[model samples]
Target: MDITQLVYFIKIVECDFNLTLAAEKVHITQSALSQVVSNFENGEGILLFTRKNGRLNELTPAGHVLYRYALEIVQKHQEMLKAIKNEANKLVGSVRIGIPPTLLRSYFIPFLPEFISHHKNIGIEIIEQSANELKALLLDNALDIAVLVQPAALNKNQFEEYSIRLGEYAAYMSIHHDLAELDKIDWSDLKGYPVGTFQKSLTSYHIVLKKLKHAFPKAKIQFTSTSWEYLLETTKDSNKIVIMPIMPKKSAKQNYFLQKKFKESLSFDIGLYRPLKSFYNPAEIILHGALIDFFNSGIMK
Candidate 1:
């Protein structure tokens, strides 16, 4: 039987043939409770109660068996809740989350230490996937949270999004490239040159690439391996430029030796997301809070 039916059944047994009293206790109508209990009895192929008055009657032998099991089930459920609350108080759990490699550099590295510090008992597992992949993982319950650009490019109903970073995006060109000689290049320029890019399949990257492709229809494009390290390697020798959102001075830096100039000025949304059910759990709450605080305060000194 469903929890609703079980609850009403338990109350009816406790109230002992007083449908009004049981209904009052459960805050449901007597008819509703009676119909639910009757349905339960019909489905179980047994008489649940004896109808002496027009209300809840006495239990049959089968009814006694069902009541005992129901009470045990209810007590076990209460114990389960108490155990979960105790675990929450201890702050001991593992949170598995997904982050886009495309944006992880800008988002994760700086925030990781603080998250670990704030919730020492919460072990974190990160699955590096494209934003699109992360979305599916979240919907399927394989991931607890995802760091992505925004909810607009995704199925909004599947995710609860919160913007954590608001920053400008820049197109990066090799210093030796001709475009680098210009003070600034407009969207219409760079049509004939190769442009370094991240995975076009990614929602955020695809959104930006759409605009760039519109501006430079003839531009040759190359996708990076979705790491800052590889992005920097492209800058060292390749003439192609990669678009990036420069981190604030406080972000964790890998190597700051390379010079970055503003190529084309643009901006995009950045956010953290999880399934709505995730917020109800304590482990997710702590980890989510840690990530929120990590972004609110700078992660790297």
Candidate 2:
């Protein structure tokens, strides 16, 4: 039945079968209300009400069923309206975000608390995966946004980009290690010790791997873990170096974790990637703004 007829039917029942009162409440003439309900009954092919001697009485069984379904449909329509209004009033929605593992530790994890607290109604899901997997997920509609490292070496058509151009990170060796004695360690310096890093799939890892042949062609690759904790624990005794951005002074309180910038640095752009067409969503805008604000206020950049 049409919305107007459904509303008229509901009003007729709610006003206790008083056609005069129902029509008065809905600001429609009694004849118009009666005619509308008559049209609805004809379209539905069922009698909605029993009229006996100019008095409308109780509904038939079929009428009761239609009324119940009609109530549900009207309620659902109202709910949809409420949801739209709520979305417009405040940024509130679910957004799935994919980020590579290394960034989750050093970037996303540390900044999450503030974002969560501020946007209490907007739910953010963070999927930790490699950059390649994240790109695929974004294209598949499995993810709303992603923070990936560039140059992704993938097709530009797949993702729209928001570059969080935090500066270069250096290949760092331990302070007590022999390479640390030099003000600058070149490609030749990393030759002897075991090479350690997050994962070979990452953008930064590939960059360093490219230069490894120029410096230490014979270097052995060992101790690969996605966890930052593994690097912290292993670096104490193993003297294995990894490439990372210099941690800010606030993190200097962590005794084992020391960082320094180098002349020979690997530049990285922490990127926010999503299907370009989806960026207009309000939830996406709020999240992107939050990330930009978080990094800008901090010393990590």
Candidate 3:
């Protein structure tokens, strides 16, 4: 009946009719959420869910009909509020952005101080996770935008992408390692060495693993980690080769390890991606533009 009830209804459906999960997502107690649903159904004189052994099974026919309208109503209501706030001031709302841990430390951290200084009124929440995890969050509407190491195949229709930088997967080794003497290393050169890279949650892990396996089926990938620093530090003193995207200029200069590009050019685009949505809030719009301008200006290069 009301917007809050409609939101709860939508959340319940999104949680696959699991009331407990829906309640947790909405930050309400299960009993309170059940009361809201009961009140709504009683007031409407209709059953929204089909019950199986006292558990929510699925949406009823009438529930399906209401769901479509509820989604539109809630979306429109949110858009109206965002529009009003945007008109009052273009940079007022909080924008949630997701970034992989590696990229955040090497690339985005440098840009944040400038962005925050310029738009002090706008709030920025950064969610650090793997590229794959960030993609899921972006699609779920939990993130306004994300910086992803763009997959070779992406659902272009589902997302709007802006290229931030192009980088290539490279071998990093300690200066004392034999491979460090080479300006460019071939995949075959890494054959017998102990390899280390990112965890399975990251796109870089899959891409590098595929290449390594194809080049040398017996490739010894000895370490996998979520932290780039950990991966670097773990291999820095050993003969182990860490495969990752080429480090940012500042980091490359400061780090003790040396980088060597692959002979085959294993490359990826670091991009800003957002779900293709009908409405974008003022903060999202401003941040998107600023990001594009910042990257294009060669400031982060």
Candidate 4:
């Protein structure tokens, strides 16, 4: 029988076989409740209760067994519904987000705590990859959302982008390096020094390397790494120069390195991106908003 039928059976058993009291408790007419139980008894071809003076007096042997199973079934069913409702009411789920190593370091790292605090129900899985790799993951449906650097002329059909900020690149070096003393520098000045860049898969690395090579074809390119730890170490070596985006610095670990303004800026746009026409879970939507708010708050300034 269905849950409602089981519930009515349980109510009648608990109400001392008094049809009027059970009907009132379950919000049904006594005659209707009696007919329902009568139909059930007839359908099963078993007497569920004994009758005296045209009133239900006591349960039969079959009635006791039915009552036990019906109570358990109805209670368990109710608990299941309550559990489902609670889950529906809360924003609870896992979200996979991709971000380039540079943005994760300069922009997203500092603001992560506040974002998590606001959405405790959302579990975050941060996938660190190059911007192009992030885009590829989005296309493969391997990532829920990503923060990427968009080229000036973006392909609108590629993905849906929510612009966050515009930024550019500059040279960073150890304070002891002679180039650090220059208020501003040009690409030609980079010819003699060892240049360290992010891996080729990174958008920043591609942008910086193209410009640096075009101007100084003979530049000493010494290192290429995906790890920020290694890149920062390269900068502190007092001889090597690292070219990276001109976003706000979050860690003082890079304090030993000085940033120089470029005579001609190498500009890029940064934003949150998602697969085109893809559906987002509740957690993903909240996180997307948090990323936009974090950018607008000038935390990346």
lDDT ranking of the models: 3, 4, 2, 1
Root-mean-square deviation of each candidate, in angstroms? 15.9, 12.2, 19.8, 10.7
Put down candidate 3 lDDT per residue, 1-301, tens digits, no spaces. 7898899999999999999999999999999999988887898799999999998899999999999999999999999999987766554789999988767776776788889988877899999988777877877889998998866245789888888888677788888898877889889998878888887777777888888888888665688888778887866678988988777777777467887888899987888888788988888899999998878888765
Give the clash count for model 4. Answer: 0
How much lDDT does each candidate structure score? 0.70, 0.73, 0.84, 0.81
lDDT of 4 by residue, 1-301 (tens): 6789888888888899988999999999999999999999899899989999988888899999988888888789989999997886675788899989887876776788778876777899999987777877787889888888875233579667788987777788898997877899988888878888888777877788778878977554578888767886877857888888764654633557888878987778887887666567778788878788878887677
The per-residue C-alpha lDDT of model 4 at residue 101 equals 89
TM-score of every candidate: 0.59, 0.63, 0.65, 0.65
Which stretches of model 2 miss by more than 4 angstroms?
1-91, 153-158, 172-175, 296-298
- Expressed as tens digits, the lDDT of each residue in 215-284 for candidate 2 is 6676555666777666656766457887655444454345553455556666677777777673456777
Q: Which is the better candidate, 2 or 4, if ranked by TM-score?
A: 4
In candidate 1, position 71 carries an lDDT of 89
Worst 10 residues of 4 by lDDT: 246-255
Model 3, position 39, has a per-residue lDDT of: 88
